[model samples]
Target: PVEIGGGDVGVGCDERGCNLVDHHRVGGLERVRAAVASVLDVEVTAATLLTPERWKSLAGSVGSVPVNLAGELVAASGDGTSVVRFPAGTAQVAASDVVDFFSFPGEVGGAGRIDRQRDWWKSWMSAVGSGKPDTNLPALDLDVIHLLGTVAGGRVRVPVGPWTGGEDVPTIDQGRLVDLVVAMFPVPIPQAPGLRPTVRLLNGTGDRSVDSAARQAVLRAGVELVVVGNYRSAGVIQTRVLHRDPADQPAAAALAAALGGGVLHDEFLSPVTDLTVVIGSDFRMDGQ
Candidate 1:
């Protein structure tokens, strides 16, 4: 079909309520509508779905792109079929192009969970950098991964490895770290515990206790455990360096040293989702 000469190509997750400054008319999508209408040779309306191909093609023309606070799209040329779409990745953008983008905290740069975050961390740890406790070693790429589920009362699953659903424990095969991140909304901690703090664990599927005597084992391990689970999916167990907590230590590092560079801290980050809106005006091909 036809293609626009210059535009922005940025990655975003949500596309329900985003901002578009300098790219389109503020609070007026007429410019965007007109641009798409001219390209499609159709009447402009407020309902459309620009496919990923279209966005990629538009972004390919530019050098760098803007994601506009993450997922965002809009309708232009009516029939609800012709619209705008945004994808996540390191794409192209124009020097003068303007695109809006945003992303959630738990989410990563691209898709699904923060798999990239995990990969990046593994790389960062090799060189090392300065962090809060400030060391000359490369900084660990610590980030949050969002699996589907509530942290209040429902059960959460996390896989303890680089992969999302797999386990990397040296001894335990197909092992999983399932825990309920019990919310302390109503009850706040009175005082920090001097000894290692312990939380309760249930089978998640049922209230049955698997490890009745199961304790976190180490007092303050270097590894941080996270539990992630969605409504329809099973829970997953994951373990990574406790970069966020200053006092906390990683349990895996000691294990990694003994394993001789075989330690598996996979540095994986979870992904998050969001809904954003495209704020701009219609456009005409002739205008550009």
Candidate 2:
């Protein structure tokens, strides 16, 4: 099973930090899936990264829009004849509510507005004075659920046991797997679109025999292998790098270099700590 830790929210578009915060590293199963698919030259699905500017733009759009009594979202065209109205009953929560959810305090310039919002919650009684809600809006637990969904999508095949995620455990069909990879990366494959993907196994069991065999598998598949840990049994090493735009050679090259160079796991890559190469049962998996 995969465990997706709550993503860290911080100010700025610094991709390295944002990536760490977004769980690019230690992102559990999501990271593993991306790495494996990237290596095989297969497509990855539902992989998306939103910049802070984009988040702000969404927030701005939400602010200008008004919520009607029925909580419907209505957008009017510049021309008098056009109007787009979203039905009220379609969503229990307003679009603005969703937008506001990403308006995290300290996410922009570290101003800490999101924390201020939390503080505001504590002061609700003072602000309301004697006035109480007509309907009970019981204590909501933030720990029980998250308001936003993950941005990456893909699947992983572990050789040993049955998968752990509930809805994620659809028997892996070739077509569905292909679709998922396509959706995640949404990019054209390299010289060979028909290329069967391969993965590098970092079984650093410290036995030359085991390492040699794994190396043979990689060479047989025509891929690179950089081993660490126990070459005999298991070890975690930089494995895969996904390519979004095959045409973007520089980007693709940089990604490859990063993976080969272990940039993602580099502690110096970001301030987020403990970017360790974890292996075995301790590792968690998350499906998009």
Candidate 3:
């Protein structure tokens, strides 16, 4: 049980003492999955740091354009996966909704404004108020559930919360958190089918922090960190995840997702390693 407690959120101090607000952290679900996958020796097929930007980029990469309905973005891929996103509670909740949608993408009985100006639940309500949504027009956006459908290979209902959050977070229940995260995977993630992917981490940024962060993410993916060193050659302005064989593609994709998506390629430097992650200066612990 992940005992939730402590000064995880900030109690901003001032002349009027500390103002306690319900502060929460968005994203990091992929990292949670990675940590659990590593500990449990399970291999997840796909992972992505789903954000508006990521959704847009993924749509573009898959060669599709998302229609902006007021503020919500919607796109249907050739693979039959439709991507919808709108600003809302936190990343996990929205994602869960998406997973639900994929299980049953209800037809748009009515359309609502998807304006970027107003995003929160209240604003969403006001925008679709009265005859629009005074009763229950429709849930505008939620792609996380759709993603879960993709991950689970079926429909599922999962709840997200501000478990252990904030910068001063060190005493968090890692084991329990991992348990919760593992549960989020389809069924309980099973043990790896074969040996975990072998990974080579190259620190192109020469920043120890970058190296350390990359190392952690790579390890969290349940891969073999076979080699770690500095990238000797130049021109690596951005992080890149490369794989030598088609088989390692999933592992490479998982690593890239853990690192918040980066340049990916098939370098084909085979017989040495399955995947290579070159840490560039652009990489950040915060997916900025």
Candidate 4:
């Protein structure tokens, strides 16, 4: 009926939090309400859901494997009864299920046990910027698809390279390198102001080189690295991304993804940092 614009947060899972059991069992959703507030620059007390289009797609989603992080939304009709997606890749749902999909974690963006929730918003803008156009997703639903595309396209510029150092690495430590782990297709990312999360890195292996490489990887995650130092114990065998605040889980997820992988933990909440990444000896770039 009318095009409305407001601060509405959509949480997603691959299956739309619509499991036969544990309906609310969304991954990494502990404090997502707050993390999303930081992400959307809104005072979000709760998540906003869509119906029919996005709802049914997410709820009735069949595959457990994660699709593109920057999924797709095919058609946005003017009458408001259009189909949608987490980002919009495969299905078109009913208007009623739109909000229901939003209720599902697959629609939400961030970390979790499932690929749907893990890194949902990570590749959205890049996917949208391929110079390819979707006629159905053009502008009729500017209220929804276009707006989200614009916001997602404004992600902070962070590079993904040299995390696992090699001779091929460039001398320049200032720009982004391709992270094959997260994105199969790479696009130049834009900027989103005032929402950058903070991070801290601890060298658990007691290896300065490991610390150096991880710092390089932070460029990929795009979050501000406030601290880079040592983990008290060098005995750590595996890297870890730790945050005490549930609100920081999103940041932890992003960092973990950039580092290729890490043991994500909700413990060790710190007033000084949003996330602490303890670099383990096991840390290595994918396929490195």
In candidate 4, how many clashes are counted?
A: 35
| lDDT tens per residue, model 1, 1-288 | 111222332233111122233225342456555544443223334433333543333333323433222332333456657554334443222323222221112233343223332332232222222122123211323211011112212332232232232211112111221121111111112122323222221122221232221112211121221222221222323211222222222433452232122223222322121100011112111212
- Per-residue error at 283 for model 3, in Å? 0.5
lDDT of 3 by residue, 134-206 (tens): 1223222445435422433333333333233432232344555554443443223344533667777788865
Worst 10 residues of 1 by lDDT: 271-280
Model 3 lDDT, residue 44, Cα: 61
Model 1 TM-score (2 dp): 0.17
Candidate 2: lDDT over CA atoms?
Answer: 0.32
Give the number of colliding residue pairs in candidate 2: 27
Runs off by more than 4 Å, candidate 1: 1-79, 82-84, 87-89, 92-110, 113-191, 195-288
Per-residue lDDT of 253 in model 1: 48
Output the TM-score of candidate 2: 0.22
List the candidate numbers ranked by TM-score, top first. 3, 4, 2, 1
Model 1 score (lDDT): 0.26
| TM-score of each predicted structure versus truth | 0.17, 0.22, 0.34, 0.33
Q: Regarding TM-score, does 2 or 3 come out ahead?
A: 3
Q: Which ten residues in a row have the lowest lDDT in candidate 4?
A: 1-10
Top candidate, metric TM-score: 3
Q: What TM-score quantifies how close candidate 3 is to the native fold?
A: 0.34
